[model samples]
Target: MEPRPLSFYLLAAFFVLFVLFLYGPTLTIGILSFQGPEGGLTFPMRGVSLHWFRDLFQEQAVGDIWGAFRRSLVLGLMVMVTTVVVSVMAGLAFRKRFAGSAVLFYLAITSLVIPSILVSLGVGLIFDQLGLPVHWAGAGFGAQLTWTLPFGLLIMFAVFNRFDKSFEEAARDQGATAWQTIRHVVLPIIAPSLIGVALFGFTLSYDEFARTLLTSGSHNTLPLEIFGMTTNVTTPVIYALGTLTTLFSLLIIGVFLAGVAIMGRMRARAGSDAGKGV
Candidate 1:
């Protein structure tokens, strides 16, 4: 058995503390969200109750929390599917050297470097010039894609780098077409990473505020709604909303992880059965 170095233990402890630093505030908010109706934002729980959670549903001056939440969900789902499809296709394309591929790669990098507010304004202006109304699903979606696609592309680059080409060659030798080879073989192997890309896309799009600010002309997404809430309300309902959304995000991550685990188990069982048969 190999023993890990002392540096490994030090790094592990550092990572643990880093995670606590990130999630400690979130846990505090989740707990305080249950504070009594008269509770203020921070500490010293007035009393523990579901008052704030219930308050999220009741009408208030917080600018239609339910509507904004639904819009965010719709936008997040739309972005997740689009990002997976586009990122996977782009990733596959990048595997081959095409004319101007490097230029395209650099262009994606440029989108990342540019300030998001400028992209939002540019998109808004373009939509205005075209006499088109910017909907959450329209210009806003495109703006988010500009942010998400580059990330998805970079992740896929790393995934593909470690992938072996022999599997595809073997599939071809068995008379499989290109599409069949990809669908039956390549996709299964990379499905987990693609799920990760989907998660990134949805999370980025859902929390995106700057790029969404100008483009989402009519309706506000969750982040914009939360910002609106901060000005209009002086209640713990906002923390309640944050806790709910964080739980939703965690649920989505759990589902994806379960899918990955199930796929792995299925593959392992098949392999073991084949081994026993041999």
Candidate 2:
């Protein structure tokens, strides 16, 4: 083959630099997880051990970290469910012509473009003025849901846009009611998109730190718990947690890929059988 052009070399270099920028910190933390507590910044190579991983469990605030992690997990789950239901309804409503639909859609888009800090602060102040229940007060997960819902609606809109209306029409022709058609046809057709949306909402809710700091008040999610530790002292324990989180994220991605692969194979097999019959 002929030698690549100068532009090709420049493009390759840019791609490598981009990957390093994105993953360098994560890689460093993962490596640091293997360093012992007394190892400090420099690694002795042979002196490296799994002591940090073990000590991570024995950390003074392990219980608190676990509690925060549980809270964050529950909050993520609730946000995902709430987002999916609300977005689905909003998606359907926006699919048809209606009064003020454009205005409502614009407002939803504006929410996404607006900074989370302002949204959090505004909601926090309103809650304070209204004397809302203590549980719903500033920095709480409930308030965070407001921000998640708008993005969720946007995702649902994109998913619904590609949905084939023919499926609903076919069901209706067979004497099914509107609700039945939606329950039986539309849901199955959009199942993958719905899963993807839920994952997006969960990730958004879990990683939200700035808004959580403003709205969480006395409650601590995992992000807040992790960030709180930074003020006093930094330790390899944080690196250990980072490693675990990275692994968890990889696991989720793996499961999603497996699901997509299975679906693709099923579709391919169905098409192959159909062609054989023809």
Q: Give lDDT per model, in order.
A: 0.90, 0.76
**lDDT tens digits, residue span 1-278, model 2:** 99999999999999999999999989888898888657764455336789778866764745477877778878877887888888888888988989999999888878777887887787678777887743423346666776787887878888887888887888999999999988988876776777777777787887777677667766688888878766754567778887887787677668767776786677567543545656
Q: TM-score for all predictions?
A: 0.91, 0.86
- Candidate 1 stretches greater than 4 Å from native: 1-16, 271-277
Largest TM-score belongs to which candidate?
1
- RMSD of candidates 1 onward, in order: 2.3, 3.0
lDDT, residue 108, candidate 1: 96
Clashes within 3 Å, all models in order: 0, 4
Evaluated against the true structure, the overall lDDT of model 1 is 0.90
